[model samples]
Target chain A: SQQGEEDPQALSIQEGENATMNCSYKTSINNLQWYRQNSGRGLVHLILIRSNEREKHSGRLRVTLDTSKKSSSLLITASRAADTASYFCATAGGGGSNYKLTFGKGTLLTVNP
Target chain B: IAGITQAPTSQILAAGRRMTLRCTQDMRHNAMYWYRQDLGLGLRLIHYSNTAGTTGKGEVPDGYSVSRANTDDFPLTLASAVPSQTSVYFCASTAAGPNTGELFFGEGSRLTVL
Candidate 1:
């Protein structure tokens, strides 16, 4: 079963604009992570926000997690053409390292240059 | 480069045939996983190994098997290929264990079973 569900199945924006995607999971999670995949390529780890962390940042990416709501949001500031890809949110089942995670359907983000 | 490597970048197999997907990581990660990506199913975990000699089943592991004979290698084998088994297989590894969540993924192996 899928643990997380991403909002806005698809989104399109100008290169300089900001793009936001939301994710909601059904069960508790150890951490929520976001990954990006270019066409016909493997996913690359983007950022991870633990249950204890409310928000985190890396470069132009920002992530916020709410354990109570079982939801997380990813914000891409100043999007670029290179940012065009599918973004996925995966949840690590709460409380252990070896525990498996479930992946969401993912949101396709297209940043037009 | 220190990263995961997968073999047979893509393959087309016949039904009832057996196939193995090879994965190797130089990062010395303790956790390795095999996941299949379908059009609407997202990425479903097939199997995983916490460390060398320990293998566990993920959400989807019916016709697949995995072995962790060493720290750097984890291979996923399909006992019998089926049409439904056609999908892109991904091999991932994480050194953070349960504490952190960052998976390093290989390019991927696309398998088409006819």
Candidate 2:
């Protein structure tokens, strides 16, 4: 059962363009996190936005969470070809010390140089 | 820093065979999780342990079992492999606390059950 669903399933953009991906969840969550996975590699934590936080940023990655709407968005500004990869949004709802997270199918972002 | 380590980077096994995927984390995090990734299925949790000596089932616990005898190790086992069990498995860990939800992931273990 996927708690979150990423929009656009896939996105292709030219280098230096901005890429935005949206995620909607089924239930209220404690926090939402974004992770990036390069081809054939492990996932790396990007950013996390708590329910109380509307937006957060790390380097060029920005995340926004709307608890009322049960949705979140990830934005990559001034993207580069190196930024091409699969992005996933994970939600952590009330329970289990927030250790357990539900991940979405993911959005594949391709940056063509 | 070798945050998380998963054994058997890839494996191929016949249906009905028993297989276990090993996972170990050097971070000493209190929580460990096993998730399976299939095409269009995203990542589904199979099991998790909040601490050593305790384990809990997640959304997709059927056909899978896990153990956390110690804080650093969480191993997932399949009693009987099936074709549907073929997928890439990821092991992750995180510190137990409020406002700490980042999960460190392993490279992943690809299993093919035929």
Candidate 3:
């Protein structure tokens, strides 16, 4: 079973607008990582937030993790047409092998020009 | 740097035929993984290897087998392809230890089984 689930299966916004996606997990995790995937292509690593860190940023992306709630959110500011793609959150559990990540269903974002 | 690459961008195979999907990483990472993506179910792990000579099952491992003979290459094989196994396959790799959770993926291979 998938440990993480992203909400708002899809989202649409005009250029320059901000987009947000949420992910909720069922188990305790050591870290959560986000990835972006273009159509029919590979996934690019976006950012990773450890359980000890509450928030992080990279370029136009901002990630927040709230362990108390077992949830996390990714925000893309000043979205551009190039930001259109699918975003996924993957969680690494605490025990056993922490190398494998359980991915969420993902959220598809469309940035209209 | 060609971080990672998967062979046969796409393929068509017949049911009961054997097929192998190749994955190679130049980063010399110690971990590699194979995942299958479907329409609505999202991506599910087929198998993973933490390092050379070590392999483990992921969420969906049946019907598929993988080997990490060397640190640079991890290959997934299907003994008897089935229509249900038709899907996009992805290979990923990451450095060893705690940071292994951060994966770098390949362009993916689309397979169609008839």
The CAPRI-style docking tier of model 1 reads medium
Ranking by DockQ: 1, 2, 3
- How many backbone overlaps does candidate 3 show? 0
Clashing pairs in model 1?
A: A30-A94, A97-B98
Q: How far is B24's C-alpha from truth in model 2 (Å)? A: 0.7
lDDT of each: 0.92, 0.91, 0.91
Q: Write the per-residue lDDT of candidate 1 for residues A1-113, one digit (tens) a residue.
A: 89999998999999999999999998877889999999999999999998999999999999999999999999999999999999999998834546676799999999999
Q: How far is candidate 2 from the true structure (C-alpha RMSD, Å)?
A: 1.1
* Clashing pairs for predicted structure model 2, backbone only: none
- Listed in order, the DockQ scores are 0.68, 0.65, 0.60
The sequence of per-residue lDDT tens digits that candidate 3 reaches over residues A1-113 is 88889989999999999999999999888899999999999888899999999999999999999999999999999999999999999998743344788888899999999
Task: Give the best candidate by lDDT.
Answer: 1
What is the per-residue lDDT of model 3 for residues B1-106, given as tens digits with 9 covering 90 to 100?
9999999899999999999999999999988999998877888999998889999999999999998889999999999999999999999988847644588999
Error of 1 at A76 (Å): 0.4
